[model samples]
Target: VGCFHQPSIVLADTDTLQSLPKREWNEGFAEIIKHAGIRDAAMFEEIEEVAQGVGDLPALIQRNVAIKARVVEADETETLGIRALLNFGHTLGHAIEAAAGYGGMLHGEAISLGLRAATWLSLQKSGLAAADGARLLRCLAAFELPLKLPADFDSNALLDIAAKDKKFEQGAIRFVLLRALGDAFVSCDITAEDMRAAILHLHEPV
Candidate 1:
């Protein structure tokens, strides 16, 4: 048996972000973009603005927290699948992290690639417009996140690992994909072959 609990309150001191290296500082932007992609489409413009210049960092962090809090509070234990929206790029991200042997590659870097894969999948499976997907890519590029699959990454190994993700249920992958900017949903329609194709597409050498 497992227990789930939400803390009485969640707090962050954005000032502490000053000490992180630029890599660490930028990592969470992936998740911020994910949150905006899935829930707050309007934030996408704000993100674009921030990319060109700094914005209200503290306010932006709180806005992200609020987006996540709403999703979590609605489906506390993931029983409703609502919280799975949070896994938008993590389906393949975790596999890539493991493929990297858990070192050298940062979690967010793996996720940026995973985000690319998911965005590609969305274009095919969910009617996501090329322009929408391009916007997402620009966000990743703006952060200088890796957009290519690491050359050493093995597709078969990545698939095998992804199959074991928590998002898989009854041997089906509930892959998260976007329908449009600011919209995402879990999909059981994705297949290993589809994932493989996306992996190869990423080998284009960005």
Candidate 2:
């Protein structure tokens, strides 16, 4: 048997993935969210450390090790599961951003908003504790991730876009819910009306 080309691996010593293009920085960050087990304080501390000195390659790569582990452990079934988790906030998120067009919002930023909405739903459907939801909200805020939809976005178009996400099964969209930090599961029974209400409520002021 012959192996073709080099295996893609994220270097634990280097701050970057040698095989990955520089343009994929955000793509790398996308893996960060899945490691929900890491405390928010440590995660933000790493972010701050990176901001202070991007030249510290070792520390940056160390922070991303768990992400690499997940990817390395990925098989067909687990890969799909991870990908599905990544799509958590993507339903309404992608549509709002696409309709608003580029320069309006970054992809991760939009998805962050979606994550918040999904987490909100998780609280209702998956027994997510109030403290966990609050912590998630705070962590997203610390990362400067969005927690609300843009004011100009159209609700129906967003819903249509979300509906088209492949996570939908038998015509119902499935969502990943966090039962707690470090634990998440998926379900499709959440109604659109409730989802939309959650999104809308997140946008409203106290």
Top TM-score: which candidate number?
A: 1
Clashing pairs in 1: none
lDDT of each: 0.85, 0.60
Model 2, which residues run further than 4 Å from truth?
Answer: 1-8, 12-31, 37-65, 68-72, 77-83
Q: Which segments of model 1 are wrong by more than 4 Å? A: 1-5, 169-171
**Model 1: per-residue lDDT, tens digit, 62-124?**
889888888998999789989989999888888888888857689998889899999999999
Candidate 2 structure quality by residue, lDDT tens digits, 76-185: 34445654554556666676667667787777677667677777788777887888777666656555566666576677776777667666676667776677766665
Where does the lowest 10-residue lDDT sum fall in candidate 2? Answer: 33-42
- Please state the error at residue 135 of candidate 1 in Å: 0.5
Q: Residue 138 deviation, candidate 1, in Å?
A: 0.3
The TM-scores, one per candidate, come to 0.93, 0.70
